[model samples]
Target: MPKALSEHETEAFRERICDCAARLYVEEGPAAVTMRRIATDLGCGTMTPYRYYPNKESIMTAVRTRGMHRFSQVLEDALGSPGDGRTRSRAVRDAYIAFARANTATYRLMFEYPEPHKDDTAYREAHERMLRTVVAHVDVMIDEGRIQADAPIFGHQIWAALHGAVMLEIAGMLPPGFDAASLHTRTVTALIDSARPPAP
Candidate 1:
């Protein structure tokens, strides 16, 4: 009989499976992620991954949920930094790109892949928390007279612009000689400039 794994070993093995699945999904897209493939990548029995995750979708959900939680932490750290509105905004923007660059595959999968199950509370709550963080930051800016727009609407607008730039960079669609960091800085600055209250 196979030796039983200790609880810590079981949890570590589960994380390894999820990490491998996440990388596969990011590198080869959703169709390439499978329970058997994950088990093979981890050098385990074909049934090992299935014992932890019922199917490929469950593994995907776990990956996505973990991504969301990490993302929320990034945003939270940015929001908590000591700074004025523009400073905080810049920190958030930088953090956003840093996360994407550091975890390219997982970041892409988080935004591009659809959840296999709609009822995954962990994924839903984690995603919602990230948005709420953005909204809270927007509220702070508005209170400081830094932003002149609806908090949620403006926050999502900023997110869209940042996401678009990051996606283009990831897809290699940006023009040759384009400096992504500079472009991102200019894009963010322009948006902030446009949102400022007009002078009397």
Candidate 2:
């Protein structure tokens, strides 16, 4: 009989499976992400992937959950960096764009892909963690009197703007010489300025 995989080996293999699944889903859409396809891509037996993941949906959930946690960490690191509110806000914005560009496929999976199991605990918690990171940054600005707006509302607005810019860049929809970074910077700065209290 074959020796069982060590716990670390098991986790490594799971990550490999998720990486393969994410690429297939991004490149060919959900229809292409079958268990057989994943196994074939990994050069394993057809049933090998099934041993690790019960179904395609579970694999996709794992992929998305992993992506969200990684994304949240990037944002959290930027938020936690030593800086004033405006500086830290820009850091988070830059980190958001950087992550999207670097992990376009995973980014799409996290936001663009339809989640049939939206209530899945891991995915939902990761989603909420990301949301809280954004709102917490906004709260920092508000506490410093940098802006006066509802944390959740302003957080959503900022998130919407950044996501729109990133999506356009990802889709190659932005016109020539108009990059997502510049657009993001300008839009976020304008939003922050708009929320500022009037000068006495």
Candidate 3:
């Protein structure tokens, strides 16, 4: 019998599986992300991946869940940093773009790909954590009297702008001389300024 993997080894292997699966899904489409394909790419027996994930759908979920957790962590770190409301919000914006650029496949997996299991607890929790972090940043601006809009509404608006800019960047749809970072900065600044209370 093959020796059982240690806990650390098991987690390492699982992460490797997720990484491979995400790459395949992005490059070759969903039809290419099969257990046999993953095993072949990893140079393992066809049955090896099944030991870690029960099916293709579960593997896809794990890939998305992992991406969501990492994405949330990036945003949360930016939000937790020492800065005023605008400064921290800018930090969060930078973090979001950096994460998407660095992990393009995973970013697409998390947001663009169809979810394998909408009811998956891990995905839901990670998504909620990300949303809360965003709203909390807006709440900071509200607390500082910098903006006078409902937190959730303003937060969603800001998020939509950021996501739109990022998606365009990913798709190479932005016009020449207009990068995602610059566009995002301008967009976010406008959104925030628009919410400012009128001066007396």
Candidate 4:
């Protein structure tokens, strides 16, 4: 009998499976991302992927989770640089847009396609953690007296604006002569401006 994989090795193997599955998802849509296909691509027996992931939904969850983990780190590093609240907010917004554009396939797989009625606990929690990261920055703005709104509400507004712009750009729906990067910067600026206290 073969020796069982160590914990670390198991995790690495699982990530490999998710990587293949995610690529197949992006290249051929969700229908082509079957466990057997992943196993075949990985040169393993059909049961191998099944052992790691019970079904396509679980693999999709893993793919989404991996994308979220990497994206969360990008947001962290972007906000880690020395800056004021406004500067940090702008950095975070730009980082968000960059992540979307660079990882268009993974981004679309994560958001554009939905897996309904599936137990996506890890994906949902990772999503909330990303939101909390944004909220923390908004809290900084509020505490600095730069904004006059609920931090969570304002954070969500920032997310909404960024998401809309990125999605529109990705779908090629932006108008001719429209500059997405400029629009992204302006959108973040406008959100901050909206939160500013009116001049007395």
Candidate 5:
């Protein structure tokens, strides 16, 4: 018979499953992650994960949410790091690139990998928060007269440029023999510089 879990233990087990899912998802994409696999890793019954996550998508959402939360924290830490707004912005970009490189799977899920869902409240919110952070950075630049203020979502435009470069590099869409790391930095610098086009 399976051992019954107390209320505290049940909650702890649920959290454990979530944590394990995140770790596994980071190590491997969602395609390779399954309830049975998680249960095997947890040494629990195959049905145990169902008790916590109704489906694989549920686990994917939870793992994706967890990764976004971590991303937000990384942005916060990078923004607060040494130097002025420009320097701090670069730090945030560096943190973002480092995080992607370190957690390739999470980065894939965040940008390259895609998920299907009807109601993606958490995912939407996390994406919005990420854009807001970018907008805030551009706001700083605008205050310093680095970028024009008239353009809407000027910051997100910068973000889109960054995402495009990073995604291309990760998706192996870069030039036949281009330096990804240097190209990534160059693209970011150029985007920020371009966002400051002369006012009409």
Candidate 6:
């Protein structure tokens, strides 16, 4: 039997578990992370995390959902300023990279490491909402005839490319002498170039 977590304890443990998992995932990998390990890392006694989550899978699920929710904010804020779709689109990429950089552990766990497939309705909904928001932006270009009929694919293409670039950069896969900001700018620029129609 596990000790019960109070309201404050729940939130605190939740955040702590996520933080510890993130650090561990980044430093090691998801396989190396355990509920007991997280509790240990956070200086909590064993069985503490179990009170909050049933197991590591649940923790990963929580992390994934939180990652998606955080990503939606990044996408929304990226398009804040008034600009051409191309520029605003880069803002979206920038926001995404920022999120990846700031949340390296979450980003790695969400992408690089593998987790069991679960329906995760909340994760799916948040991810879909993010996609729709971005696709809607691309749809504008499509409706204006600034993009091809397959603009939805273009939207995801840009997102996938950005994710790869951000992941590689964060994972230290990029070669030396390359500035991260420059790489980010190039990724954003390339995606925009490929996705956006030529200027009149």
Error of 2 at 114 (Å): 2.3
lDDT of 2 at 119: 94
**lDDT tens digits by residue: candidate 5, 1-200:** 76888999977887677667766776775566888999999998899799877987787776666667777778778888877778877777777777776666666666655667526898777766765665566666667777665434666665676667677777788887664456666776776677675866
lDDT of 2 by residue, 1-200 (tens): 88999999999999899989888999998899999999999999999998899999999999888888889999999999898998988889889999998888889888887878889998899888877886678999999999999999999999999899999998899878888888878888899889999998
Could you arrange the candidates by TM-score from highest to lowest? Answer: 2, 3, 1, 4, 6, 5
Q: Give one digit per residue, the lDDT tens place, for model 3 in 47-130.
A: 999999999999989888888888888888998889799899888888999999988888888888788587889878877886
For candidate 6, lDDT tens digit of each residue in 1-200?
A: 86776899778769779878878877887677898788888888888788788988788778877777777777787777577765676667667778878887887777766556446787678667766765656765566665664767877776676676676787688778764556666765666556555677
| Winner by lDDT | 2
Q: State how far residue 190 of model 5 sits from its true place (Å).
A: 2.8
Question: Order the candidates by lDDT, highest first — what do you get?
Answer: 2, 3, 1, 4, 6, 5
lDDT (tens digit, per residue) of candidate 4 on 1-200:
98999999999999888778777888897789887788899999889887887898888887788788878888888788778988887788778888888777777777777756345778778776766775677887888899899888888887777788888898899878764666767777887887799898
Tell me how candidate 6 scores on lDDT. 0.72
Tell me each candidate's TM-score.
0.88, 0.93, 0.93, 0.81, 0.72, 0.78
Clash count of each predicted structure: 0, 0, 0, 0, 0, 0
RMSD of each predicted structure: 2.2, 1.5, 1.5, 2.7, 4.3, 3.6
Q: Which stretches of candidate 3 lie over 4 Å from their true place?
A: 1-3
lDDT of 5: 0.71
Candidate 5 residue pairs that clash: none
* lDDT tens digits, residue span 8-46, model 1: 998788778777988987788777888888888889889
